[model samples]
Target: MVLHAVPPTVPRLLTDRSTSEPDREALVVDGVGALTFGSWQRRATGLAERLRQRRVAPGDRVGLRFGAAEWLDFAVAYVAVQRLGAVAVPVSGDAAPAEVAHALADCAATGLVHGGGAPGWTGGWTHATADGDDDTGDGADLSTSDGLAQILYTSGTTARPKGVAATHANVTYGAGARHRPFRHSRHLLHAFSIGTNAAQVMLMTALLAHPAVVTLPQFTPLRFARAITRWSAGTVFVVPAMAMELLAVADGHDLSSVRLLGSAAAPLPGPVAARLAAAFPNATIVNYYTSTEAAPAQTAMTYDPERPDSVGRPIAGGGLRVTDEDGRPCAPGEIGAVWMRSPAPPRTYVGDTTTSGATFQDGWVRMGDVGYVDDDGFLFLVERDGDLVKTGAHRVSTLQVEAAIHEHPEVADAAVVGLPHEVLGVELAAVIVVSGGAALTPPALRAFLAGRLAPHEIPSLVHVVDKLPRNRGGKVDKRSLRRSLT
Candidate 1:
């Protein structure tokens, strides 16, 4: 089976032609405003032109710090940099000054595009640059498929945030396979924050596809649901937690227009997936699995009740390998580390090629996740290898506890980890979010897990938190949880 390759001029193909058709609705921000295809092209081109005036030449890096909701601005800046053959580096809007400074210096970014009053930057462009002329040339040479397009900083769940360098071709190809088919006139809604590669891909795909995107400043179930209803959007992408929040608010809202719901960033617990399927009976609920470094929708499990745990088969043009510790293939039902190889994989880490080499080997990227393939070829993730907890003589997968706890009807969310212990070496611990008015205690949780898990696997410590600490990407911040415990 041959993997599909993304073309070198994919970006140009998506943006240039769409921009030429002026009156077409190119983008829409829920509470902000809207932009026509012609306006989007001219503005983005002007931004590129302004960057050139600032001496941001080909190969230079431009740091973008803004909320995810600013899709129009991000699209213009991103395409502008790409048009000039420069790299766009997007960091979270809420990143600390030190983190922002590190990314700017690390990527050797020549200019910065941020929201008004963004902290810690001495000088750069803002929306003021949106009106400049297209000085980068109306018809400049097209960028190579392998040319660096952006550097996305990881969430740093275990260590410092690392810059994942993605090429234009890699993103274009990945987007091609993962992009949900929507017409140019289709209205869409998504939370903004292009810091993560998954979100970036969604933004670019929306722009390239010429769909009118409705950006939400932040995710609030009511606001998001209102936007979908207001715009009559046919599609939307969000994490499982966000979906659950929407379901909670869906009580009084009409969501019949939303036909496609894509869930990613974290595992969509089976219960949540089931609830979403029931609520959006006509919509296709897709649970996707991929990392910031690899891009979106690499693998997905559509709302199929028969295979609730499967993350589905690989998307076209992507390949998966379940390998043992030594990097050999594992047979069906045999657990192993999940590795993926794509034609457009990240070439290197922005500041550290050594670490990049360590992550990518012989063209295959290690996901740092442990799971196995069944005889039917579906992938089931057990837990992140980094999150594995060891206790006494046993290696416990935290996901096992998480899954078991999530199975409880009163539980809304759950995260499991290993806490420092004196006698057991390390003991299992859990932080859970329970439904309102539900009573949850350590002893009660222990009893719930009695027969489902081994005595040792039962969480010895349980804490009920209002909400789990999640980074901008929406994954649980286990590192922060551990720090809080200490």
Candidate 2:
């Protein structure tokens, strides 16, 4: 059942939940422990007190270093920072010391709290504790009081990761902008690292909607399936990469209670989406799309066999426009640059004005996507940011080629990139990970996509490998793949 409207602040939501159902299970870390709403608050309060003692004043940025397996501690520190009117800068638990240093410096973080996952980070800040008086978490939640609440870093696939500063509303999004407990899914589940935007979504959803949010310390196919069975989770969020793992072992676990399964981060390759749809027959399989900078303006599509490639239209109060290279609007079926506009405050690149200016234009954020809206207004993503391949006179979409490759039943996952070619400027290449050790050849795959893609879209060369290279966020590392193969 739906609860009443929620407070604007993150801490306030926790406070209200504890006030309403102090005994209810608010968070569960599979294989580790569980916390009631009240218990979680005490720890957050304890953390806040420590931060205050360390001179972490309002508007200060506190770096949270935790790995995928340390959600409980990460959760406490994240809220504790907000409790003190400070911005939370989450650094992935597994980040290299150098990477962590860059993120901390980029946000001008004053201190750091580790979950023991950041092995070499030399930054300062005490680990969060939950031993304080019950009144500790009772402090005002200034998350929504104006200044930034979080500075999430984009995956540094190309260069230095940019800090994307988000206000409380920006990070929370408040159950699609409504402040209420959206309990359509009684319990929520996910295995996302704390720093990513998708993980923040799960965090906010747990506070605003799901009664008990269960998370895996680190997402493993077997562990993920077990969490759903053990907690009887009704909703689960996974990136396509994690989704692949879940699909591999879903048969060994009892996942009958799940009612909604969502995928975000990168597009769920067509074959994987289809597999997920079949695996969770009782659930509505959803394909959602969002980025670190472009959020709330996200798109979602319930799996439709007839149009599995479509990422669906923009959410309410938001829309997408496809513009040609010349900055002119494209008609339906015409591919071009995709831009997103949402009602939330526009995002800013913390210290990089040149990149921010090029990305955030007028009121719309350049999604750095190349795709088009269909006749039905559905937005189908062709390629993501910097995911273009210049081939001869054609600019080919790697995603299009990957999707076509994924359509082949023998293929498990695929990544496409452009390689330098003496005659055509750049030629297409594909790295494919086959399903069940299935036999496939570059020539056979090319013939399969012949009807679906243009001559230039098919990979001129294909590498059959055991796996595709993926970055920390579970997205294909096209650049790395290109560099290695070339």
lDDT (10s digit) by residue, model 2, range 181-202: 5376667888877788888877
Badly placed stretches (over 4 Å) of model 1 are: 1-6, 9-11, 123-128, 131-142, 174-180, 183-185
Residue by residue across 41-109, what tens digits does model 1's lDDT show?
Answer: 667666666667677777888888776556667667777777778888887777888888888887777
- lDDT per prediction? 0.74, 0.79
Deviation in Å, model 2, residue 87 alpha carbon: 0.7
lDDT of the structure predicted as candidate 1: 0.74
Top candidate on TM-score is 2
